[model samples]
Target: MNEPGGSGGAEGVRLQKVLAGAGLGSRRACEELIAQGRVQVDGEVVREQGMRVDPTTVVLHVDGMRVQLDPDLVTIALHKPKGVVSSMHDEKGRPDLSGLVADRRVFHVGRLDADSEGLLLLTNDGELAHRLAHPSYEVTKTYVVTVEGRVKPGVGQALKRGIELDDGPVRVDAYTVLETSPRRSLVQVDLHEGRNRIVRRMFDAVGHPVTRLVRTRIGPVRLGQLKPGQTRVVAGNELGALMAAVDL
Candidate 1:
């Protein structure tokens, strides 16, 4: 394992690298912290990126808040209920995940629209969050969608084949019809795309506008019996699977 500072020694690690490893953000973003003079070493503001200090011995602070190396990498699964935004704050006074989880430092891995609900992963591990959110990883996300009108046979195939939206072409890896009725139909669609409202828009593009959307799974983790407005820690083999999915 790499030490907090590259190779433990009298000289500390690079400030930006230390900050990034601490889950603050990417190295470039951490560099901005140093440039903004918000980073401090031993109570002195450090605007230079080259400056290094031992995390164990030297006192470090950012924006007047003490910066400590978080030893525990926390990741939690939240069954976000509808009407709750995926963000930490909503300027319009809408509910958000911050209220559900005690740790405000952790952020949602991806986003579920305010109107959509289901399994949402929140974590303080910035690197893991970045890998999971990136399109290249192709992390599978399964959704249980309820659409208006009974979906025709060809619709599922069409979705699997691919559809061109305003942004670009989108397609589902798998499509399954779980239930069907004259007025409504329930379908399970699996895809790796993480665009905003991609599932809803995909069905809408196929002329079957979605009535309700709920994410059932992400990678190896499932929503399972988790009820609305509930959260649980992701650990054990489940967390291991998630880490494996992203090649962590």
Candidate 2:
């Protein structure tokens, strides 16, 4: 990453990356903006996608409006309650994350289903969010799952081995029996896959439907004692560990 523009003589970062990190959209979209001559650097119309600029010192404008680099990145850990939609808005008028956080600009890093509840990271730092959501980073997410019935002996091992889902093959990084009863079993599972409704579907595929699910951890960040419908800023070593997880 290029150092923030200063007299230290650091080279400027790629224009598209700077624009994308500023929440302009994807790098591709930012490239399009540059190609269309909508972006200007230091009063010069920059059409070249490879052009780099110092975000801290260089003046950037898109569509004639000044583009300000976000000086302080805000990341929040939210314990999303059940029945709340993961999106900013729901067509059905269902409750969403927007109600919990006053700022509509910050977006959820990854999604939890309406029926699922757990630690959901919301942030204005699009680049970090992109890295976390991307499967290549292999950020492990740990979950405590409650299934409808006692999992059979081989089931846990099977999940650890691998399972063929509709999208592709997936396997848990770790799996352990937390508690088991005749009617229900609580199991802790860790996986890097971020497919939609994966935890519930994984158990459902194994003939044991999920009764309840809660994500306990994402990378090194834990949900801890955060209550449902509550939000808190991620800070200190916890935030540092998360950024390090994605090589940010």
Candidate 3:
């Protein structure tokens, strides 16, 4: 059975997560609402911590106010440009992504380094963000890399084998050659680990240092047709496709 605004699922989800997914507020903001004795489930105020609710059955109200659940979740795919950080806002007032998102509350699914450009996911669903960013999920990402030198034989094998980094071992799930030249080669590197600068380091270790890298895909969502600095909302089965790819 499906609740009026919640998905039909048997799994138990945190009240704060549901509220945040409902776009009432961020997860932390929902917690504050709960702590203040303002949230109600089935007509009873819930001040208890870590309250779990079935999204398919619970009738939730926040701040003694009834919140009509959002019918569709918001998911945006952004083609981030180099030099712009993935953060919502920068203290230095650099061109952050917040200005590009029309909604006030949407947040990036994960962090992308300022120098790297390509697909970036933005969503209002915190639980989805948690699933996508969690290391345990091992979300696969494909990057189109331009390296400074000709890729040696077994370089791709070296990436798959693993490279030692400051954090720990970083490895690619799969990779293949795209194009090659004397000074540069473009290879597609697929990685399960989402460590910072892992792809660059992996190539550097194998003697083919990456000069420019752009993430072309995250699971099934591609940075397709989206130019740099452009944004568009995802709809229909694209949401299911993405979540399924990340095993959410």
Candidate 2 segments exceeding 4 Å error: 1-71
Clashes found in each candidate (C-alpha, N, C closer than 3 A): 0, 0, 0
Q: Highest TM-score: which candidate? A: 2
lDDT of 2: 0.85
Write the residue-wise lDDT of candidate 1 on 54-103 in tens digits: 66566566666555454676888889999999889888898988899875
Question: Candidate 1: minimum summed lDDT over ten consecutive residues — where?
Answer: 1-10
> Residues 124-206, candidate 3, lDDT per residue (tens digit)?
87777888998887788889989987787788887788878777888788989999888999999888777778888778778
TM-score of predicted structure 1: 0.72
Which residue window of length 10 is worst by lDDT in model 2?
1-10
Model 2 quality (TM-score): 0.73
User: So what's the TM-score on candidate 3?
Assistant: 0.71
Computed on alpha carbons, the lDDT of every model, listed in order, comes to 0.84, 0.85, 0.78
lDDT of 2 by residue, 1-248 (tens): 43223223336788899988876789999999999999777767888776667677776667755555656778899999999999988889999989999864799988999999999999988888999999899999999999988889999899999999898888999999999999999999999989999998899999999989999899988999999988888864576568768865
Candidate 2: the clashing residue pairs are none
Best by lDDT: 2
